[model samples]
Target: MEGEEVGIRHQTDGGQKTTYGATGSRPSSGDERTAQIAGTSDSAPVAATDDGTSGLKSAQGVPAGPSTSYSDAVGLSSRRKKAIFLCLALNSTFVMICIAVLLPFFPQQAAKKDPSDSGDVQGASAIGFIFSITPLAQFFGALFVGRIIPKTGPKMVLMIGGVLVAGVISLFGFVNDIDDWADFLVICYALRFVQGIAGAMNITATFAVLVGLFPNNVSLVAGTIRAFNGVGFAAGPVMAGALYDAGGFTLPFLVHGGIMFAGTIWLFFTLPGDAEVGTGKKGNKMFKDSFTIPWSFVWCMTMFICGTTIGMLDPNLSPFLEDEFGLSATEIGLVYLVFAGTVAASAPVTGYLGDRYINPNKLQPPSMLVLCLGLVLLGPWAETNLTSKLWRSIISLVLVSIGFSSGITLATPGILNAMHKAGYEDTLELHSNLGGTVTALWAAGLTIGPTVGTTVVSAIGFPKTNAIFSIPVLCVATLGLAVGAAYALKDLYYRQRTGTYSLERQRLLPSKDQSTAM
Candidate 1:
């Protein structure tokens, strides 16, 4: 009854009295009858014998299949994953806000650079130049970070970055004259570069770790991080403006540097060690050098156009708002808050929608369209006779936020996807270099955009300049989307038509385009 049935006639090693029995007990009349019934019936259940044979019957629970067990074990636990993502997002928010805090003060700082004098062209230019210089260092530092991360890992880099940045901030307090600026600038640039390196490592390494740690809801993690980034960019200005008003430029820098340094240290301690996380690989070459593109000139043009608009426009916008609207520091801060708010609020939803419901690549164009509208409103509407033009500018910037968020979410992922498809297995290095390339493009745009925006507006008038300058931005964003789409379409067409796509050859073309663009 309990297990297999054995016959009394079964032989043993030595002659002994033996009888038919079930596994648990001697066979009763009913048990014997059931065993007899099992033998006669073709469909009767059977149990395992002590000798591992199936004899008398009993049922066993079926074990789980491999796929079912695997799914259960690997799928991210939604609650735990969300918590980790939330914390990381919070960190991103803090970092972003810190970076942009100085932006709203640029005009005021320029104004103060020569309080006794008027027409502070040199002062404004110097500030703008100062802002631009950091990105250059940051650009190189980011690449260096990418190279060093696998060896030194993110933990050490972040710790070092924080300390250096704190020192730079403290040094700003002692700057007494223009001569002092040179040393300060060098320090600032160096610190910013290191900060950028740390930023790159922290973000990339964290994202990679999250993907493995969470598994099921990667978009949620990305959204949280990105949303925080937006929040920081938006809120930082207001906080900085308030601080500047109360404590002056010197105080804000000192406090900010100290606080940020503390944060960096906190992150160093609270975050896991490099051993707990995986580093994919590091490459010696710059990111852009790793890839080649077909139709090189076209894509190169597209990258420049895209970079110019995104990077250049924001830096100029702060100053333009000041000169054009006569907005105070608080008002300028509010503008950034709006810009950042729009980005932060939309990032998570957009990330989710892109990752889940919509085709990821397809999201790029619509977002660009929104960005174009934003730029158009900001630039062209400056001359509108209506009282609503100022409000319209605000509305337009909101759209820009949407577009910007979209571009960020799509562009980075899109490039990564492209590289992976093209068989660039060293994605970390590729991404790092790609970031620098984008940063350089952005920096160029930032440098040129302000000079051109101010000069062109001064010459052609604000409305005309806004409209004209916006054209390049619109062209670039649209062109980028188009080229990217074309790349995707070409791959599909070739694969379906000829059963394979020449990815390596196609990649080489973008490289050529880069050289042509340069």
Candidate 2:
């Protein structure tokens, strides 16, 4: 016991260095003192009060979080960042394709499977039930994926997710072989639910990985991935249509599924090292530090609005274009392409600015305001008694798409940035948890959106509904922007005086038992 070694904790606050030995033995003991608090030096221990330990702890007797600034916390290599970005791009570029490829192709195919369904009414209904299973499953699955990420590690979770999604999708091609309607519905629904859970896993882990790897350049990285997401969504129908034309219904699923599998393969080789993504001390915890900081809710609300609006348009927009503007299905699809293009084009630019110059609060609110204006214009100036013009509609659609892109890009990083100021640990699990919170809400919004779009539009008409939706967005954006600005100023003032943006919260830090290795 005399010659045995013990760990000692050190902290420097206001030019004072305090030391607390784990065994309460003085440095005069024949033992070694390891300087392990973010590599701070083994400076001479000070003559301290409270047994040299009470000030270093919290009321709960848990060890305090680090006092070091975020910039000094950790460093990641460029090679690792590239590996992460590749994994994200591949995953994003293919998952949506796998998901969306069925949209333009499945209902008619399923309807034909039933001999009595000549009119295809029951087919449409049954197919809708099948398609809806995935998102609904994902809604619940998002709640648990974060907890799993910290245990299984992100890379493995991602691998399993990718495999599940790809496997389910590839198996879709075999559905044509089944003739009985009941059996077909059962198989389709089962596959969809499996893929849905897989999607939840993939998205949650991908976001968590991004947060840990590219904390400094989050906006650009997120924006780039989002760009790929839009591309995949836009390309899915086009690819499906083309492949169906060439190789029939089975080809589209097989091709898209194969693409997703390729992404999974690339991810296996590229991601450098695998570990449980986060501190993951808590699973599916929503807003882990909301009491300390409340910004995550604001972004969550923004995303909910965005998702609902997207869902709203998906059900109503094409018909509106056809009936109101006399556009054909092809033209309407081109308009949809334009919308996706705007999102893809603007996301990275907006994200780059968010990282370098603009703050998330300032960026998101204004972008939503732009969306509000676009919606109003799309609504024929919202009760101004003028008919909506085609050009104006296109412009409005572009604005709406860009706003959606900006809000999505802001959601995760915006929440995480606010948390860091409160001194949340930068663990993969932490990112996954926050990511799960926003993701679940977004899925909820989408789930509710179609119903709202149909009912609201029918009740008050499109123009009034668009105008009404703009009001809540405007109110939320104004409040969020104001709060963001206030915090920005507060952070600036805090940094100018104390030399750090963080309050350096102490309760959230790792316990001494957890740090004996480092």
Best model number under lDDT: 2
Q: Over the stretch 116-166, how does candidate 2's per-residue lDDT look in tens digits?
A: 747666666567767667767777787788776766667788899999988
Across 109-228, the per-residue lDDT of candidate 1 in tens digits comes to 445544435566665565566566655555455555555544444456556655665666556544434345456455545555554554444454455345444433445455556777
TM-scores of all candidate predictions against the true structure: 0.67, 0.79
Off by over 4 Å in 1: 1-87, 103-116, 176-223, 244-250, 275-307, 318-329, 379-388, 425-448, 477-518
Relative to the unseen true structure, what is the C-alpha lDDT of residue 352 in candidate 2, on a scale of 0 to 100?
A: 90
Q: Cα deviation in Å at residue 79, candidate 2?
A: 3.8
Number of the top TM-score candidate: 2
Where does the lowest 10-residue lDDT sum fall in candidate 1? 62-71
TM-score of 1: 0.67
